[model samples]
Target: MASSPLGRPTRGTTGTNRLRRNDRWIAAADAFRRAADPLVVDLGYGASGVTAFELATRLQRVRADAEVRGLEIDPARVATATAQLEEVRAGATSFPADLRVSFARGGFEVPLPDGRRAAVIRAMNVLRQYDESDVAAAWRAMAARLAPDGLLVEGTCDEIGRVASWIDVDAAGAPQRFTLSLRLADLERPSIVAERLPKALIHRNVPGERVHALLVDLDREWDRAAALSTFGATQRFLAAVSALRDQGWAVQGGRSRWRLGELTLPWAAVSPLP
Candidate 1:
């Protein structure tokens, strides 16, 4: 049997709850919870599989039958993750019993047994090492491994998960929405997420681009809603998002998600400049 094509390995830096925002967003997504097979893939889960385990825990809250599988191009990383799973099974760690998580040695091809497909694939910080031009090919490859009603979430975030952004793609490999999550305690501007945008939109954060205008408008609204901060950052964010929606920016989700420092907008509202 021929081995799968090996893609570039990531820095492999990961920590507990490093992807909490993304996992929470996925758990709340109707598509993820409604899938018959709620299998989630944590692509490039780094040197440790803790994030994958955490993802399983978060999703299981919404869909009790959810399962998480961590994939890494490096076989050694897979071995490490497997060992971590064993420790969890033996009650050596604080892992939950309902947390069904596993590890696999795979690449962008997403080699899985029995032609299994996933309902959601979270590829965080995996594409930061690759050229921006290669993102579409990787997206297509991973999207191909999805179940009919699946999602491909790809993005980057800061080391401690303070700031993050991702693009959601459907099983058909079409980009749907872009989301940004941040720690708003002392957030200076909403455009700070520009640095963490997915590879597809990071470069497009410039004048004349839809994404650029969106971020600019977001910051403007954030400033305008500063009065709401007297109530809370969440309130201010919700108000800002509401303002964006009123301005015709297709902003999705409501106060429930906004409270967690999350804002999602349609891809067309931030598509790259031609």
Candidate 2:
């Protein structure tokens, strides 16, 4: 029942695999697989529908009946993406035919055909244009349209998908966890992701804050783990995260996720700037 303040349109930059990290995480989450209604919405999928098509392909591996709909505020983008979808279909591009990917013109209202409720909504890089104050309201608005037990994955990422962070929100609009995914090769400090943090924590990366301290500590551990570089960047990152856990931070997940360049922490550990 809420709505965005409706800011000016974005440049609509997009590309294939730009959201691969988020898509892969969503596909593996129990939230998507357990849903009776396997409808997923790719909100504000930019000028291209490549991410939406990729989302459908990834989700279908878990829920074969899954459907992905790409929503854009600009009608022209919607039309363009629709035409592209037709071409892919006509060429027998090996996409999930039963997945039924489509595009529609809609803003944060998330207009869906037949008033269907979504089992999951992935709104990546869509809110970077809005003021931080609008984030909670936007989450409430979108989460309200989710089916019971649905999830709302909202966050931002850098170009080329090298660094990304997202918050997992429940149907009640409460943030459950924050996940940061990055590429560890040519390694710099892990905290470099502070620049790419979600809108909520981007500005909170300063002294005295938990996020700031977390990043600081992560950098320290990363330096200490530099000795593990002999094994590889992945191994060094695993060691850094392990050190973070040993330091009593409520870091979640295990080596499997860490090896994939991801680190998920409880939201309470790093809320937002005051």
Which candidate should be chosen as best, given TM-score against the real structure? 1
lDDT of 2 by residue, 1-274 (tens): 1134233455698887889999999998877889888899998899988899999988887878889988887778889989889877786666654547988777666777777889999999888877888888888888988888999999988888988899999999899998999888865878878878888778789898888988899899899988899999999999999999998989999999999989999999888646
List TM-score per model, in order: 0.95, 0.94
What is candidate 1's lDDT per residue for 120-168, written digit by digit as tens? 9999999988888898889999999999989999999998998999999
Candidate 2 clashes between residue pairs 3 or more apart in a chain or in different chains:
none
What lDDT does each candidate get?
Answer: 0.88, 0.85
- In angstroms, give how far residue 132 of model 2 lies from its true place: 0.9
TM-score of 2: 0.94
Inter-residue clash pairs, candidate 1 = none
Per-residue error for 105 in candidate 1, Å, reads 0.7
Question: Which candidate comes out best when scored by lDDT?
Answer: 1
Off-target runs (Cα >4 Å) in candidate 1 are none
**CA lDDT of 226 in candidate 1?**
90
For all the candidates, what are their Cα RMSDs to the real structure?
1.5, 2.2
